[model samples]
Target: MDDKTRVPSEITPDQWTWNVKVDPPFHKKHFNANLVKYHDRVMGQDKLRVFVPLCGKTLDMIYLSERGHGVVGLEFSQIAIEDFFAENDLTYDSEKLDGKPFVRYAARENNITIYQGDLFDLSSEVCGDFDASWDRGSFVAINVSTRAKYGRLMSNLIKPSGKILMELYQYDLAKCTGPPHYAEEKDLVENFTEFQVRMLSEFVVVDSPPYYSGDDFQLGVALLSH
Candidate 1:
């Protein structure tokens, strides 16, 4: 496959059906520190609806739901979603969307619902508007060509008063072709002009994921608000 077409979807056909090496191959078993550390600033409101895009069975959903916040997650992998519930020992009811590739999974024990399908398939009316968005790996996972579409969806889902806490990697992109693609300041400005972007902090990625170049790679934490 050409460089542009190399993406997350291409890994799936072999990953679940056969043995394939994929970056961060297993579903994450722990909470993302960016979410926990910036909790008060990003998701301070109680019972607020939070959107988690490209969520790979992240434990942050449990963290949010337990704190009385509603969590909505979008993921393309059914295997990952099922593994999440099974590994976490959570019971959920499932419903297939009519004429859609998505199957909705609602956790019976918490205020968490996950939509299993392509992230691009989501719409505000379908997933509902969110007061806050926690984008751990979502935005960076987006291919540069499709970032505009992703930004448009965020525009629709994010309320005027909503906030978005995001984590991204900053590095030399040409050398390291990535699913967790490197993002620049101009990229965000061009795609998400409706919101004000602020770089909160930067920390060295310790034990950096295999996808990264591992040469002093840094993780950037940012907050976006309308």
Candidate 2:
């Protein structure tokens, strides 16, 4: 489908709950290399607080915590958050957020917390501003219609000097439908007008998922700063 005629995903929170049960390939058991490589540059310190949007059961959270960073994750599925703690063998305490359809889980011994709810509902009031942010697949995974809102929320969540390390994908949208949508450099710049956007790396990915299997999927990592 052409970009103009493309249908946006109508995926609900329930659908994401089911997706986690089946174990998707995008779910990795280890740290994402891009996140590890850029952590120091983007976050700068070991004691910083990092915000992660649409954070599934990514091991990147654990990786960040191991390095002494306080990690806050926003997710929609309770299953995903539960699985994260279970898989990582961490014990946690849960509490409901007042006046919100969400729960917060805090790991007993780690500086890691995950809030379960629609990411759009997040605000600085809900969670204080962060020092840094990470977007591994979130920009591409969310429906295109919400991309601007996503960017705006991220901007609000971070401090003025905070950096965002984002991983995105680019491909011919006409050839595939996606939870992983095509995100161009222009899209990033347009949504994050307050920040200086820089494409840190780009490469053709050979082993993409079924939706983009035959296409030349260009994976990119961008660093955004104020």
Best by TM-score: 2
After superposing candidate 1 on the true structure, give the runs of residues whose Cα lies further than 4 Å from its correct spot: 1-23, 203-205, 211-213
lDDT of 1 by residue, 1-226 (tens): 1233333332332233312233245346688787889998777756799998888878888888877898999887777788778767999999998877779999898788999888777888687799999998788876767888888889899999898898877655444666567775567878888889888885455555666554656788888896
RMSD of 2: 2.0
> Clash pairs of candidate 1?
none
Cα displacement (angstroms), candidate 2, residue 178, comes to 1.0
Candidate 2 structure quality by residue, lDDT tens digits, 1-226: 1464767465655566445448766788779988989887777665889888889889999989988999999998777899999999999999998897779999998999999998888898888999888899788787787878878887888899888899887666666777777777888999887888999886557467765656576788999896
Candidate 2, run of 10 with poorest lDDT: 12-21
- Name the lDDT value of residue 109 in candidate 2: 82
On a 0 to 100 scale, what is the lDDT of residue 23 in model 2? 76
**TM-score: model 1 vs. ground truth:** 0.86
